[model samples]
Target: MNRAWRTVFIALLTAGVVGSAAWLVFVSPVLGVREVRVVGNLDVSAGQIRQATGVADGKPLATVDAAEIEDRVARIRRIESVRVSRGWPGTLMIEVVERTPVAVLPVGGTFALVDRHGVVIEIKGVVPPALPVLRLDRPGPGDPATAAALAVVGALPEELSSRVAEVHAPSAETVSLRLRDGRSVVWGGSDRAADKARVLVTLLKRPADTYDVSSPDVVTVK
Candidate 1:
């Protein structure tokens, strides 16, 4: 008799638990998102994010597609990666990873923001502060020269790079550097970038007028 009673109690308890879960999932629907929180956004604005998602407060939380939101965010240039999550009970979260702009090049009258990957990310209203101005005649979306330029920039010594205000690849025959300190560096080609960096460092110690590392082993002092 006691065994039968215990089994009945267990069945009742199971039913109650299932009913409560169903109520919470179907009737209550407390998992609906009410807000979206964004983080790590420097390029894309919150308004832009909301506009891209077409999701707003009061939208059904259960239907918030994180992957869809991420796809929309990816369409926006300068946003390298995006992640979305459901913040239960009233919030949807969108985290975006923005591509870092490495330099600014004058495309037309305005400046183009270029990333390390050599992709032009944006054209700003005004030139950003303290970024290198690349002046390659053939710097376009299709030019491998742009990638080479970025690689050269990446390889340059900090002291030399910070002193540089502009870089010019006149015809790919030579890569030139114009420094803020009234100096120039003739980095001939990208073949010996590290060696060129070292040579430039040594040349900088005395300061003639310019240091030519086009042939790093056989440097020219001007």
Candidate 2:
């Protein structure tokens, strides 16, 4: 019995030493990230992402929390979604999904980049020439006005999208369109959005200055 107890104690002591050594030598260093890989980024540079992430070359790979990296990267306004992962002993991988500018919103005198869902992603110095502006009052997330704006965006005809100057949501139920050609499209409300769009498209093909599609079936252009 004494011999058996001595053997067990020695085995336990040996395991503890081996575990500590492995943790100290292998796991501790791997806790810091040594390499970083950025993917799915455009307009924003890899260097910029790396800097924003604050993940340096010496960070322990195993110690790096994927959620922490994701949160850090997501702090940048242009990034919509991010994923972070560590590869084996030394590599840190970052995958980011960038937000594409869909429209511009008036921010005081300047403009802000709005996504297709009407999310104001970034405040910018100048509005991009290609994207149209969305003129809307401040609406919180999931507000009816925001829903109406998104509806109008979805209802817009592709042919007219480029020529649109702004989408005006003056009220929750009403939307008006300002065209690049100095014309207005009066869309009375969110009701029958697709119907209004179809009628508007047909009338746009004609030589008209102003269109009123408030009543979808009986649209008029002058």
Candidate 3:
């Protein structure tokens, strides 16, 4: 064949290939979604996540808008973050990071569950046994006192947290903890939290009226 004809033939072949690929990715039913999968959910149910995504079976996976789906999923208060993606061949995948509750706040006879970021996750009529109650004069996401209490709550070891009944943050610099057994702990500010937690844990072994680990290096018991 002549060089000109050969070049034309190659161009037509490339165009056909690109067109076919575009059709498969953008318009074909072969890549359509048959299933929607959810991962990383704890407090929220998988069914709720699927509903939030607004992704239906038989929809084109390539056409699903990940950012829009994420926005929808994020509307659920318990979800901290969400990632939406298309699973090749026949699935739509949604991964979620649920907010971890650090403390609960009593509001008008209901309990508000809040994460370490001080964002309220949910409100329940009854307090959950696992989380400690947070005592702040004014509790809100932007409150400095709530943030300080959250820092201290988040820093506490699991062993200590399990024994805690309430967290008090009168001011940003003044934080304290009340244990389930009626013992009081003066935790002070959020600084040196790990050291303070360790000191408090050790001091809890001995019976005392008040345990002050605010200055971990110079702990006091009253």
Candidate 4:
């Protein structure tokens, strides 16, 4: 009401607003991260992901950079993709998708574990039994033949894949599989892979030295 009193009131109000802003931005206990949670990881351990994130405990959640954390986690060789988010109150969540190896390519003395995209995910002296060996004269991730063979391997149902010991791809047009029981499957190229897979699954029930799903509609057995 009075001019001096009004001035004092405005000054006090401004100080309170500034103080609240500072407390929220610089010193709020409720905004600090107390936990980091990891999800969707198979091969990668949760502790490894947490370490990769580089998010320090008790740091302000608002200051945590999701993009930076995701980029750091994505650097792991086995990780296919990652999503980092800040959970309200006191948690940071990280979700990771790891690359699944579908085949092994013998390169030099070591076998390179490759995913469906033909990207080499890992390498070791011995190939894993669950993965089929991929035979390519010159194996490159971007090679058409390698991609086609990988596509075929990726499409095979678990039952069918269990019986396949190796996949031979000399060229994009000549994709074939060698079964564990000594039968061969001529899979042709990557085209109509799902159809070929369906035909081959049914055709394998019969006895044959070689099964051709090269032209799945008109398959031949030898």
Candidate 5:
């Protein structure tokens, strides 16, 4: 064949191959999703995650929108974050990160478990023994008292936090903690949290009714 005819034939063949591959990947059901796998979820069930994704079985995997799925799953209150990815052949993988409750607040008959940002993670009939109780007028993300109380709780080391029974914050500047053993701690505010935590750790060595590490530079025990 002549050079021009041969070149034209090669171009047509390449276009045909590209068109077929596009059909198989984007339109054909050969790569359809058959299962949705959820992982890294503790409070949320796999079924719940799958339902939130809104991806029907046998849907074309390549056509699925990962950002849309993530936005839908994020609407679930307890979920901190969610990631959606395709598992090649016929699977959708959903990874979830759930919020950890730092304290519980009494809300009428039930109790609300809140995270460090004062976002309510869950509601329970009874308080969990491991979590400290928050003493505030209104416990929510917008409430300053709730924010202060949760901030103090978040700053505490795990060992100290385990001994804390209650966190009180009437205002943003007056945060305190009541230990399980009945001792009090004047935490003041969220500023210099690392310094205050260190000083408080050392002050607990001495016997005292109240430990004031509000001013970590000048700590006091009474």
Candidate 6:
């Protein structure tokens, strides 16, 4: 073939290949989503995640927006975070991390399970045995007393936290813990929590009715 003719033929072949690939990826049903796979979710169901994605089956995979799907799924209050990814051929993958309750708060009639940030994760008819009761005038993300109580609880070691029955925070500066036993802990505030936790661990070894580690440097026991 002539040189100019060969060049034209090659150019046409390339264009045809690109166009066919684009059609298969963006328009043809061959590469469309057939299933939505949800993972890393326990409280939220796969059906709920799929519905939140708003992606219809048989829609071209390449045309799906992962960021938009993530934003939609994150709107579910129980979900702490969500990630969306496209699986090859015909699948959409959604991974979600649900909020975990750190404490329970008494509302009007029911108990609210709240996370470390004091955001209510769920409502329960009765308090769970594993979580401590948080005593505060108002329990919410915006409440300072709630914030202080959660901060103190979050700082406690797992072993120590399991013994805790209630967290009382009348104000931001006054936080205390009531152990499952009659023992009480004066936690003071959210500040120096790590130091207070370390100090309290040592103080608990001594038999005392009340342990004050609010000032970690100068602990008081009675």
Model 1 Cα lDDT, one tens digit per residue, 109-218? 89998987777898987778667899887887667666667777878777767777888876555778888777888887677889989878888887688788888878
Best by lDDT: 6
RMSD of 1: 3.9
Q: Kindly indicate the candidate among 3 and 4 with the higher lDDT.
A: 3
Off by over 4 Å in 2: 1-26, 30-32, 117-126, 139-147, 154-157, 188-199, 210-222
TM-score of each: 0.73, 0.74, 0.92, 0.89, 0.93, 0.92
The sequence of per-residue lDDT tens digits that candidate 6 reaches over residues 96-159 is 9999999999998999999888888889999899899999987678999999999888988998
Model 6 poorest 10 in a row by lDDT? 134-143
TM-score of 5: 0.93
Off by over 4 Å in 5: none
Candidate 6 pairs with clashing backbones = none
lDDT of 4 at 155: 83
lDDT of each: 0.79, 0.79, 0.91, 0.90, 0.90, 0.92
| Ranking 2 against 6 by TM-score, winner | 6
C-alpha lDDT (0 to 100) for residue 149 of candidate 3: 94
lDDT (C-alpha) at residue 219 in model 1: 84
TM-score of 3: 0.92
Off by over 4 Å in 4: 2-15, 22-29
Q: By lDDT, highest first, what's the ranking?
A: 6, 3, 5, 4, 2, 1
